[model samples]
Target: MTCDYDVVIIGGGIIGSSLAAHLASEKNEKFKIAVINSTGLGMPASEAAAGLLTPFQLNELENPVRKDFCFKSFEYFPEFFETITSGSSAKHIDLGYRQAGSLYLIFSNSEFSQKENETRNLKTIEPRLSFLSKVEIPKYEPLITRDVIGAYHYPSEAYINNPKFLKAIYLYCIENKVEFLNTTVKKLNISSNIVENIVLDNGQVISAGKFVFCNGVWANNFLKEIFNTDKNIIKAIRGEIICVKALHAMPLRKIIFCSNGYMLPRPATNAFETDSVLIGSTSDEVDLDKIQPPLSNTVSGISSLINLFKTLVPDYKDYLVSGCWAGLRPQTKDNLPVIGKIPEIENLYCSLGHYRNGILTGPFSGKILKDLILENSTEYNIEPFQINRLFETQIRGIPKYASI
Candidate 1:
């Protein structure tokens, strides 16, 4: 049987698009790749991401494997950004990558002490981590309110313009001849254990040698349909962000964080036309069945973000609200990403569920997927992210859908 393409990746977000770009970059064997998406590229999470590259969450991650994964992805970012931008003539596009570091504000002596201990523990892996005293906080950010007693600074942390980064990867994929199909997948043609073809909502059928599910929160729908189970392997966590411009002059030079939320310098876009910053976010888990638009910012969510910004930078309370938006992050029961081949299904795989770390880990995740498809060994530990780790013997029979 002849296949229309070598691989068909489902999802246009960073994870899937990065995988498409990686496959397109292969010199030994050029894979004919097609990316299918219901919405436009990076509509939900990818474009809406605040683009923080700090591994400070390392202190919060209990799993050793996850800690290493986060750190490795953090270390791999510089090269990944360069690789995506090298040949593209899109110099006009500001990818907004900067290594200016991040500061987590501490409000009281007790909070400072707690954060000091936290930074000390994190210093083993992140040596650059340090605590700044109340007097020293002004050295990095003078605009921080006096309520901030101190802060923990990660000097090597970076930030990027997520939408621009996604666009760059998408352009790279197009330059490498990757086809993008703009439609929703209706179902999979599963027969005897392999996904031979994908049926679209428009009644179109496309054949492929292999199928990869990367559709983020919506992956739960496909999983339920294929496994004929009510278990939601991947769930949606909604986060909202608001963009504001500094009416007078730029008030921040580095990313600032507090207990409420975070404010980071956003590269001035055509909409702002001046120095601006992104203040966000609120993480609230919503029932998948209830979200009509799937992604949208609530008035309360926007108000909370504005309050967070005001608390962080009380001196600059006169900022202009440019835009507000929301996105759904794909989370798993265990909170680790689902990458690698699916159990019992030949020529089928998944690269989903990176959750909050999708942007930070996306390019490397793509590398992992490319290596898996090509049967090449990867240096990073991927055993913890396998399908059987979650599904086990439950993946026994063919999908409930009709087969070709």
Candidate 2:
């Protein structure tokens, strides 16, 4: 089949946008690229994330490959932001990029001992990390409650304003001449395991030499519909976050992580005047059929977060509730992302199932996908993230705090 474009990327989230930006920026504008999305950029999880970039907090013992990938991606953020902002007309975009560090609070003596043992090894991986005693913890974050215990402070960790970053990438892609179609992909017309064309819901058939799916949880349905393979690779895990205006005399200086949940302090910006903090999230693995929004704002979820805040900070009652929102994370069975070519399909690729760290790892995932598409050599081995691995073992449910 003759192709209209060299590549058709489905999904306008961060991953897809990053891939389009990278591919469009190639020398000579070699490839014709189109990005298709049902909703515009930052829809779903991309916009609803806390934008924490601390990969070291993930469970390295269980999924070392994902941990390594996230760490490398976290390291690439500074340069990635610079490149996207420098190339686009939107030079003054504020990404809320901050290296304010993260504190993982410990509440019990047993937990403190465990962290102490882990810290010895963590120092080798993250040299700037330190174990702060209960007395020292308040010195860093004065608002923290005097709940008798210690904490681990990772000074190298950081965060970004995810929504702004997504917008910047979209603008950067446009500046680089990447076309975008605001539509839904109805089907993939495949013959002999090679996708020949993509059928849209509007009755338009688009042809592309190559196709990449970055559509998050929707990819599972797409795969089942196209291949008739019920490989349950991606599941939608709903996470609800609450945003509140900070009432503290001094704003939270760093990311605060506790056993129950974590909070991110977003400083006042030109767009939003009041300094606010995000308290999240409830990871509920709901049935895909019931995944539609009005994603139930339960009293239990909100109350749990409130109680956690009260436990962590004495002045938790001071912060007034602003609003609450929810997004479905494309969590994989193994808690690792699916980011490679399908074994049975040629010219078809996937970069989905990023779960909680999508924003953190999206750029590096894009680079990896680009390298795979262009057949360029990559420094990291991506074998562990392949789709075939799901068939090899029983898919396990990831705990809510597995990555924390």
* Model 1 quality (TM-score): 0.93
- Native-referenced Cα lDDT, model 2: 0.81
Q: Write the per-residue lDDT of candidate 1 for residues 1-404, one digit (tens) a residue.
A: 88898999999899999888888887423568999988732356888889988778555545667667778888888877777788565446678888888999888888777677667768887787887888988889887787866788888888888988888888878877899988999888787877878899899999998889989988887787777778788888888999988777655788888877888998665664677789888999988787677467888999888778777777656788888888888888777898888766778889999888899999889988888887745666788897555563665433554353
* Segments in model 2 whose C-alpha atoms lie over 4 Å from true places: 40-43, 392-404
* lDDT: worst 10-residue window of model 1: 395-404
TM-score of every model?
0.93, 0.92
Q: Total clashing residue pairs per candidate?
A: 0, 0
Instruction: Write candidate 2's Cα lDDT for 277-388 as tens digits.
Output: 8888888886777545556667888888777777777887788989887777998778899888765666788899999999999998888888888874556688888776
Q: What is the C-alpha RMSD of each candidate to the true structure, in Å?
A: 2.7, 5.3
